[model samples]
Target: METVRTVCTICPSACGVLVRRQKADIVGIEGDPESPMSKGFLFPKGLSAIEYMRHKDRILYPMKRKGERGKGGWERISWEEALETVTERMGKAKALCGPQSVIMLRGAAKGLPDILLSRLGNAFGSPNITSMGFLCFVPRVYAYNATFGCFLYPDYDYPPATLVLWGVNPSETFPPLFRRILKAKEKGTKLIVVDPRRTESAQIADLWIRPRPSSDILLCLSVIHEVIRRGLYDASFVERWTLGFDRLERHVEGFQPQVTEPYTGVSPEEITAFLGFYTQGPSAIQEGNGIEQSLYTFQMQRALYVLEAITGNIGRPGGKTRWGNPKLVERYGPLFTLQDLIPREVRERRIGAERLAPFAHYALPQAIVQAILDGSGPKVAFIMGGNLLLSWPDSKRTLEALGRLEFICVSDLFLTPTVMMADIVLPAATFLEFDSIHMPPDFTYFAHVQQKVCQVGEARSDVWIVNELAKKLGLKEYFFKDEYELYDEVLKEEGITFEEFRRIGFLLGRKEYRFYEREGFRTKSGKVELWSPDLESYGLDPLPKADPSSLQSDPSYPLLLTSYKPYPFRHSNFRQLDSTRMLHPYPLVLIDGKTAASLGVKDGEWILVETRKGAARAKAKVDDVKERVVVMEHGWWLPEDGTFLDHNINVLTSADPPFARETGTPLLRGVPCRIRRL
Candidate 1:
């Protein structure tokens, strides 16, 4: 048996793992004993590595669709044939649609693939290349980018003061993290959870504010109003480190605690009490699921940051601090080797102008998907690395738009539902057969060595596939000599050497920047912009506030429908991860026990659910889990049982833009809907 030390890319948690293989086949998998995050243990999903490699669904060779799109028919092709076909078809698309038409989409959150995807896009003369950042975490990234001049998350070291949770439930989504959070809580960090559902984490909190979904901005604004009105804010800090104070002061003039209540459902007293927590210095405002997944996510995150900024609690031991390590960070310090290498004319009309801020993605993937559907700037798409069903705005809409693409090329490891829409589908290497440097999801700074543990019949890494295409299309010099050469180029200024990365499978750099302390913001004024010049430049309102509240518009869709990453899985990433799949054999919609009683819905029963966009059915999970909502786990595809029923949540999700808010991201969570018995 040959044992390899690598990290699991199944999810962003970045668990380090040890994959033991019998020759070219995986035999055993376990957590890296020396891993700082999981500490030598693995989540069940990671433990099932062998099973994942041996699963029946894994694409073992390059397959050309034998019939029409979504027909589930394919014929195996040799590497030469596959590459030639891709080169010819994609070249035609590029020649007709312009290089801008060919886009690169990432499926995995692990940073390694980005290096290749970006390179592939650049070499192929395409300017549009993106990941799921826009849909999931880019809002937080954008907010920090706009304000604090950094995207470093606070070090979450809540000690003495209150820990305010703005609707995030990391406990259930990441149980291993929950265990650590519990330990932190046990040491006297006060917990305050703000979510519509009384989740397990909220139940343990000192205070829980279950406001109506999408009312987060309103709730945060009301709290800010209270903090300012009660003379509880750190006024001196605001004056020194931030700009647009006067504008914000004027903007919030009309939004008193009472005015915000009808929208947020949070009482003035609760707002008053929550504001009271900040007086005790050295606290952190960790945003919850609600704030992070909504339309106004960026604004909500900024509002939460305001609490920290105004309190002057940053850079101190326990507050949301600031971080910056120039020699180390892969994202910001200096552009990596392949960054901006794409030709100027090719990048002239940046396709994602609606959702992104120039080269920086506000939420690139989510915005670009809309751009594709709208035919903004460019119209064709060449997707790699990302699974649209799981990461984009709405699965059904994405499928529709893909069908309309002048040409669509899907490079993936499986014939997933998303792949079913591609005009040309290419079988790519699974993570197990790929060699790339991975970053840890939890720790944020650590890097890992991801080596191939087994071979998938003739499947090659997406890196090789992309590089081959670039060469065939005649961009030889722009492409990498090999994976090793690419790493050398990318690592040119990023400091970490391949030698060092391979030794321990992880390398830790110095602690990064914390909350705004002597912080220089990135906007025109170079201060934390309460009302940014950047926003004003876009001719949009600079300061964020609650959306017009009077429109609880749709009467037919009465309940707010939303989804979250469940503990057993990380969206579709783990669908084929055997251990995690066994946890939930079929997708189910979680309904509150009280709500189910009112609707005469019982546990484990299938029911029909429809929204204005579309309709589907999911098994009802009526339990004492939480209340006032329907909780369907995000990321499962609609089932194909030959019955007249559907299973995917994307079918019902809306593809509307400005649902594409907060700088190009769409509101994927907290969707408003109503459910009935089938």
Candidate 2:
């Protein structure tokens, strides 16, 4: 009984599945109905991938920290003494605080160990790697590469005649794009949804809208000021491929919909019936991580790419298209993260690259926990597969900047609450025990081949722990001569061999709609910058701007908060899988039944919440959401009662200082907070 097939690298919807195996005992996991992008639809965290790869708190080997650091003590060591104690504490923290003090920390995007942890921090010269990409999906991929230089996605094969769903729910974080938007809402499209919770894709929306929670950039500049005051743009593709349409129509004419309806609780006839069902034609929208955990994340993703380039919906056909990527696979930028072997003053010392220097390729988990609580950051971290003490924000200032780290390590599988502040843990493996090349995130333009169906004890593979910690940190002439010679040098420009990409299990790529009408929009004004001269040459705000004092409300934190991703965890991973904690057992929150009966809360009780950076608890349900909001549920922890930071909603978030100044993106949605009845 073998079965095998492959793909589910847990999250990033790399679905596909199959597994079964009896010889080395996986014994079942299904889905792969010939996956052409999750067609066999398997979620519940990919059918509890064999109960989260045989969990019982998995972590199969390599240990160490027998004392201090969150004291659950360890010891069992040996993967050559946990790679010679993480190569002698990262070679004495790169010989006394130098390889930019050694940072790394990654999470989400577990494929090719996120380009082998940026090729092990650019071959150990370090540029402070960091992740949760400024509140996920890299500030909507740096506001779709500063407006229309790409990242559009959602073509769902040309069926959309209107789909919106902004602040996305894709029915619990993308169930294969909510079963292709429920087969394009049974062929008539026009769904809408916007979200301030009531979401099972807003009870099958044909218009749901809810606004006010970080007032989605004043409800997207009042729906781009009533779609250019009702002309409903796309005026011949904004006069042949836009570029600051009269400075984004005089900067969204001071956001109108009746003066931004009491700060976006939406109405001006529901922003003119959400621009009459989104400019009535080839629409698309999608947006999510609820406007990428706002503080106007890159100006609400550059006002949803200037509302999909003035509704012509950039590159048409069910709109927002532009796919392609398999011209022989080797992607992940700056030459697969070797980044010219780190120079330019050691990549300008990356701890938040002197104020988001165009997202200095990664450092900003709240500016490396405020530069490791201000001793100027990174005194050794490494992390990988993160939990950043229940997913970073302010869990009491990320547990006091990871207890002011002076060497940490981690790599996971479970022991996580940021692996009890590790001093070396390791284990890892899973996605059915290793073999690589998955791909499948957002643009779903395919790549496949995640084979390895077995191995458990002595776990490994985060590309064999970054190729044996780049050969004990001497960086081994910049890594590779292993993990299938790093998957045959990323499929050596398609000559093949990673066993012919696991017998061509997948590769797909070529969709190509109006690629900016034959090579335009890559920016520096090759069209579609809609008021961006590259964000006024990176000093930012060349267009999308809407503060409204960051949606006011703070009569002593009078309830706002937000958070979601629940369909049985992925962020802080499968709560020690009892079949994905029996399909999400506790941590709930929700609220609005008249603000949980004006705060004397009820539905399954429990509560608490709080905020101006603290407080946690959970339980309450109350539902239908919006009035004075609430929501909760993101990646909470229980792991069979180890209870990390008591139901961590990033211990009431707040990585501080305004943020989204072009992707330092902090706020983690709406925020304020208050609740109680615990």
Candidate 3:
């Protein structure tokens, strides 16, 4: 037996891992003790990596649809035949409807697959490459970039004396970060959690601030108002490293705690207490993706940045900090450069480009569906590593739009609902079966060299598949001979090598603080822009606002429905794995015991969760959630039982309107809904 250092790709956390193999077969998996990041700890998902890779449901070979779309029948086909068929169909579609008619979408798979998909679209002269970024971290990244000139990451090395976790459950979604938080807590660090539901992290928090769903903007603004009103802000730092402070002060005057109390469900005293605790030196706020799925996402994130800046936590040792040394992997170096390969005319033809501005570079899933329904969307689509029907909101409409597509190709490890709608399916290698690079989920500091431990059946790495496709499409310049060649090209400027990276397992430089002191913020003003002139130029608000009145709840659907990822699953993945499934056997709707009792719903009983868009069935799980809030499990599907049509939360989510104006992000949280016993 031999042990190889790698990284877990089970979820976005991408923790360092050690894979044990016996003559080409994976024998065991564990956390890497040598790595400083995770420090010999692994989540249950990481420990079950070997079993997940060797699961019986894995698609081992390429297959072609033998019957109509949505039919379960398929015929095994060689990679060559599959590639030729896909290339021919794509070429035909492009020839008839221009390059803009072919769209490339990436799913949950990280690293090479996502980049290659974007590169393929660019090289093929299509500008409609898109992914889950619209629903994930892009809004926060964009907000930070616009406000501070660079994205600031929470500094966990020297954790803050007070850390505020807003709308994020690091304990479940991010194990490494959770471990760091736990260590900091052991050392007397005060924890403040903000979420509608009582997450595991919130259970032990020094203070749990439960706000109304989608009302985080009001809460953040109220805190900012209190800090300013109490003069708890850092006057020295504000005078030196910030711009438009006076404008921000005046802008937040209307968001005082009393004014926001009804909307945010936090009293003035609580807001003042929060400010008093957070204003103490060495404080940090770790924003999560949950807020990005809410209404006014971009504005909400900008308000959080403003809060950090006013408190002098911008460059503090235990606060939000700039990125460490550059990552070893060039996540989008080629794709960034290749994006221009698509001509200006084709680029302008991108769906939703006219309205979404900065986010126009990628196709909007909602807009893609609308376009398809109107016969103006891309005629052909290539999807990799995701379940479109399950992940995208308005499931029924998305499915129908996909059905209308002229051709659909999916590359994944299993036949999902989206794959069932595809004309061709390509087998993809799991993380353990590929040699690549990985970084932690948010605020990434280090890059880990993912070593291939075993190869499963005929599954191939995404890089290999893309390379072959590039060759078939006559895009020789974008094709790499092998993973070695790709890695060499990526590390050419850094002078590092794949061999060195593999041996070392990780590449991270010493942490640097007070980056703004030297170079200042990377904004147009060369300082932290409390009020952004760039936003004004784009016809958006220069200062963020908390307009709780913007969202009017429907009396028919009184309760606010939200969603959360199960601790044992990564979105829709791992539901078929017995070990993982045993941890969370079914989808659940978490409600307060009082609310459950009022609705006559008992724990473990099946309940119907209905929204304006659709409805789904889930087992009721009584929790300490707010009376008006209901937390629904995200990404639910039962492949083994062949009942893929039920239990997914997106079925009840709408993709229609009320998106973050700047980012085109749909409101995945705070939707009006009602629940009844099923």
The candidate maximizing lDDT is 3
TM-score of each: 0.90, 0.34, 0.97
By the lDDT metric, which is better: model 2 or model 3? 3
**Most accurate candidate by TM-score:** 3
lDDT of every predicted structure (CA atoms): 0.67, 0.80, 0.83
Please, what are the lDDT tens digits per residue for candidate 1 over residues 1-678? 888888777766667788877776667788887876667768766776667666777777776776777777788877788778778877877778777776777765556555656766766767677776665565676777676666544445445377776777867665556565676688877778887766788889887886776778887777776667767767887887878777776677777879888766678888767766656766777765466666677778877776667676655566765443323336432254355666555464566555555535322654466666777644556677567865566666676667667656677766677776666667777567777777543345666678877677787777677777778878777776777666555455666666655764666555434334343555567667777777667665578766645224467776777776666766665566546656777778877888888889888888876677777788898854335556666777533331211667777776665654445666656566778898
User: Which pairs clash (backbone N, Cα, C closer than 3 Å) in model 2?
Assistant: 244-530, 244-531
Q: lDDT tens digits, residues 1-678, model 3?
A: 898999887777767888778897677788888777778888898888778788898999999999888878899999999999999999999889888888888776476567777888888988887888788887887888889987787777687989999989998888888989999989888899998889999998998889887899998988888888889899999999889999989988988889888877888888877876787758889988778887688899999999999889988899888876654555655454488787787687688776575534678888888999999758999888779888988888898999999999989988888889989999999888888866544535666788888879899888788878888988887768876788776665567888877886777755669988888788989989999888888888889875777764899999999999988888888887889877788898899988888999999999999998888999999999977899999888889855655798888888888777887878788889999987
Error of 1 at 251 (Å): 2.8
Which scores higher on TM-score, 1 or 3? Answer: 3
Compare candidates 1 and 3 on lDDT and give the better one: 3
Instruction: Tell me the lDDT of model 3 at 315.
Output: 83
> What's the CA error at residue 311 for candidate 2, in Å?
5.6
